[model samples]
Target chain A: MNPERMYDALDRITRVRGVRGAMVVSAEDGLVVGEAVMEGVRGNAVAALAASLAARLGRAAGAAEAGAQRFVHLQAEVGAMLLMPGADGLVIVAVTDQHVNVGLVRLEMQRMVEDIA
Target chain B: MKARVVEPWLLAPVERFVRESGARLTMVMTPSGQVLAQYGFTRAVDVMSAAALGAGIAASTGEIVRMLDEPDFRVLNHQSAQHGIFLGRFDSRRGPLLGLVVYGEDTSIGLVQLFFEDFVADLEEAAPAETPRGPVLAADFERDLNESLATLFR
Candidate 1:
């Protein structure tokens, strides 16, 4: 995968409100195919973890009758993680601070997922 | 390794999930990447690799959310030419369990996601009520692996 192109997409998301980091990951192996992550946070780990959580949540969505699970937003007390499908069996994971404008970030990422693909 | 004592009850939901979703294979593991129950994987190493990667990805993403002051990310879907994959979590009285599924033309992600919710709820009800949620012991890894393999292979 092209890290530069992935970085460009991630870079745009990171510019959004409360966005901290972003990366492209392989869903199959939980490895970082590319990243535009920031300091103090491990992008590799994020890619790997997001891969697992996304898979599990996808399964959960399936079992729950939630449908394709194209997008996932995990809200925690601290912040949130958002995942979207990208080109070629890849996922885009974004980290944002609590109270971030989630709606806007999601919209931007949604576009980015397509753009990157 | 994701370690835990093997219980017979865990298999029920897993089996149901496979049949209900028309998955070619299914694996129920831990957040730490240990296979608690698996169906469709031909090799033990495949399970091990998947579990490890699953656990690592879960941990990493969970931490990222926490770092950004968020709580969690719930589900993920992957599509390709040959097949599709679904992964997510379920809570039992014992602890949280991870599920991985692979399906081909026989099923779609929507069907799998729809059924996954029911599987989790059923699993929650079926889990032994007395077992408090906590970490699995490392010492039991080998024994747990052996027992689970024995059951699957049988």
Candidate 2:
């Protein structure tokens, strides 16, 4: 998938009421897909870390007798991380603060996942 | 045998904490698409009814990740101009998530985090006998996959 398209989606998520920044990355190689990140926030580190987390979760779920993992999320003290598997080898990530509505975020992401897939 | 079932008692208390703190909603979902429990404001639609919605959210928008020393702690907090949310991993200690959501008006996020720690403790203290049932088993999933494989084999 095009990084530009992913970035556009990230930008929308960041624009949501309480989001601080948003990013998209390739979880396969830990590469930055597109980033509209904040200064204090390390966008690359976030990408790599998100990729790693997604990879682990993916592996764990695949190994489970159940099925594959749909996605992975990590939350910090002030901000949060959202990782979404994309078409081919990409993953989408969003970093936001506490004001984001979990329901809205989920709805929006489900739409994005369909787009990426 | 199925793994021991998990109780969602944490939903009531955590929801109370989030609503009392003015948070719009709170939810906990497994890495997979299983939504364990959710409390707070939700649309009448069934979208908010499922548990894996959290994983769906995470996969949709990849973002900030903080690795805590304690295991089983995956938290995602996002803020919109009008609302705010904090979603985290189920606190293994408390048998549910140590999550708290606050919305409307600018809140002291730092202070809310402090309260999260306390809320976690409270959940642990109020641990119930069983957690909610995990995600559903898609009975047709394996059959579908097998059918696809059979076509390729032919």
Highest-scoring model, lDDT: 1
TM-score of each: 0.51, 0.41
Measured against the true two-chain complex, the DockQ scores of the candidates, in the order shown, are 0.03, 0.02
In order of listing, the candidates' clash counts read 39, 41
Q: For residue A106, give model 2's deviation from the true position in Å.
A: 2.4
lDDT of each: 0.74, 0.55
lDDT of 2 by residue, B107-127 (tens): 323334444555666766776
Interface RMSD (one decimal) of model 1: 9.8
Maximum-DockQ candidate:
1
Candidate 1: how close is chain B to the reference, as a TM-score? 0.81
Model 1, B1-154: lDDT tens digits are 2112246777677777777767787777777776767777776677777778777767777788778997574666688888987778666665677778788855556566766777888778877776554555777776676666665555
Off by over 4 Å in 2: B1-154
